[model samples]
Target: MDVCHYDVQVKTAIKEQKAEAIVLTDDGMNLTAFWTRLLCGCGTDGRFEPVYVMENIIPLFDKSFNYEIVERESWFYGEYLQAFYTPEANKIVIRDDVYERALAGVALDVITIAHEVVHCIQSIVMRFLNAMQCVEFKTAICSNDSNEMQQHELQTDRITSLVLSPDSLTEGKTDNEILQQYFINPLIQFVCGLIKTAGKNLLEALNDTNCYNEVKEVERCAV
Candidate 1:
């Protein structure tokens, strides 16, 4: 069975292994969607390997112009990079429904591609949240995570919003559609690259900046 279509094995994996969440595809191109996410570099790499990205997703109708989304059957634990109480499989899956978006001639399908990818980034950090207990890993951890898993999730959503702000995507597609599918392009040029904050915050790494900030922020905000 295709990854886009939920089959018995996939269903069993999600059920028995505790798949966290499944996002709807912008179109039936969920595989294309995820594969597109896999290419971590804005430009091509010499050897052509994504340094960091979501798993098994790509794009299909980029030049064609189409968009859609998919949904998960149930909610499971685990954040971005780590699994909480999940069973065995250590990966994420996004499903693409058969709907394509088109405002007669407009769609933010490209940007939404990145937006959904950021959500996967959220799940990756949630796992760290589970491990770190409570921490804030912003900076290079930009795509990795920001603050507490939940807070970081929300903040990253905000960041994604800012990156794909309505105006940023309005050159061609509708503002609303671009906004819906907005996301930050992972620029290795930024101070917030993934390598900057690797392995700093495990559930047990409370002394780390991300962890300390998490504590301080939690105490300060009372969440």
Candidate 2:
């Protein structure tokens, strides 16, 4: 789909949700409750259920894995140390620091949670597609290498933008333009290429007519 169509689809999807903007506040309990609704299956009428994995401190990935957690006085970088989706666990784990930041009203921290939620959605779609015999997509899902993982992350980021910033695409901006303006990264070009080859808009695929009732059931619970 072209940028205009993509923008329309994204805006329409966001509008249908009638989502209220998240307001930051000092109330820790309120913030936690809000996030719980956003991430847990409770909001989706049990159509989706993701284990909420939490720890008092950052955890290390298995040594056999290519990713590692790195922490510095200034910051941290690595897969396990940060919030990540583990398909094996069927869970999205948020480290203690990231959770703390969200409670403290760090917008990006909360946005990160939304990003992971998109991964949960993607997992559902992938499983459905795989069952339909989409071998390529199944391969992509099972691949553990860095390149495949990056593709998944970039795809999630694009969907997250659609969910979180539909208003930004109002001025005739293409998806690529919007991505460039707000989320410039080396993976942008490759991610777009992969999406194009798939020949279906993410929203449209997930909103398939056959799944309409199921989707509506989830939305009913969400709202």
Candidate 3:
């Protein structure tokens, strides 16, 4: 991971839940409730936050992405970010098998986890736009247009970098650079895997929000 600087906006962190596993569907409202507390310091009450992750397959239950998530049994995973989020539902998921295994118990790995959390925030913001009717809502989750989703993925990575290292990417090497060059650059395979099983049913638009100006911009970009 590279060193970068960032201000702390979120303070409360999620505590692990004791549930076995929630079904990867909507009926799992109870699980969602538990996750809301563990995830962002708030629940479905309009508390927006972000999340990030880097793994091959992990099950994540985000009301935002409209899906449940879980980790796979992959022994190997390359560098890259894989996140799924729901707009109407308000949830975000990350797969960090690679980053976790590489860093092991190192404190730096915390950033890896934090990166995925940032995704939750992104999903919430977008969903809020849809709610306010600033953007159009869709039943199916949207796919990335080349680097469209990549922009969000990289943003999460940068967010993690700021929390972990505190130095700028302009310094020697950045976590973003190393993760890309070594993990993602040579391996589109990993990203492809995320696309296939990222686990989402993005069948929702925005719920509601006050960002009229931002909503218009979001609508333009979503199209």
The models' CA-based lDDT, in order, is 0.34, 0.44, 0.37
- Residue pairs that clash (backbone atoms under 3 angstroms), model 2: none
Tens-place lDDT per residue, model 3, 1-223, is: 2112111111111211111111122211222222333344443233222223223112243322433343643211222434344333444444545344434544444554555554454344334333333222222223443243444455445544443433332246666864553335424544554555443322222223346668899999999
Give the alpha carbon lDDT tens digit for every residue of 1-223 in model 2: 5655665674454234321122112221122222333343233122222123122111222222221222333232233335655554545656667666756667777677667655544444334323433223323333333455555556556555544543433357676864554335324544665677586776677678659888889999999
What order do you get sorting by TM-score, best first?
2, 3, 1
Give the top-scoring candidate (lDDT): 2
lDDT of candidate 1 at residue 190, scale 0 to 100: 27
Off by over 4 Å in 1: 1-90, 98-113, 121-147, 166-223
How well does candidate 1 score on lDDT at residue 202? Answer: 47
* Displacement of the residue 100 alpha carbon in candidate 2, Å: 2.5
User: What's model 3's lDDT at 139?
Assistant: 29
Single out the weakest 10-residue window by summed lDDT for candidate 3.
6-15
Which one is best on TM-score? Answer: 2
Task: Give lDDT tens digits, candidate 1, residues 1-223.
Answer: 4544545555445344322332222221221222233333322112111112333222221122222234433312222211121212332232332112211222343233445455544444334332432322332222122233345335434544533332322446564644343222212222243334544444346567687898899899985
The C-alpha local distance difference test score for the whole of candidate 3 amounts to: 0.37
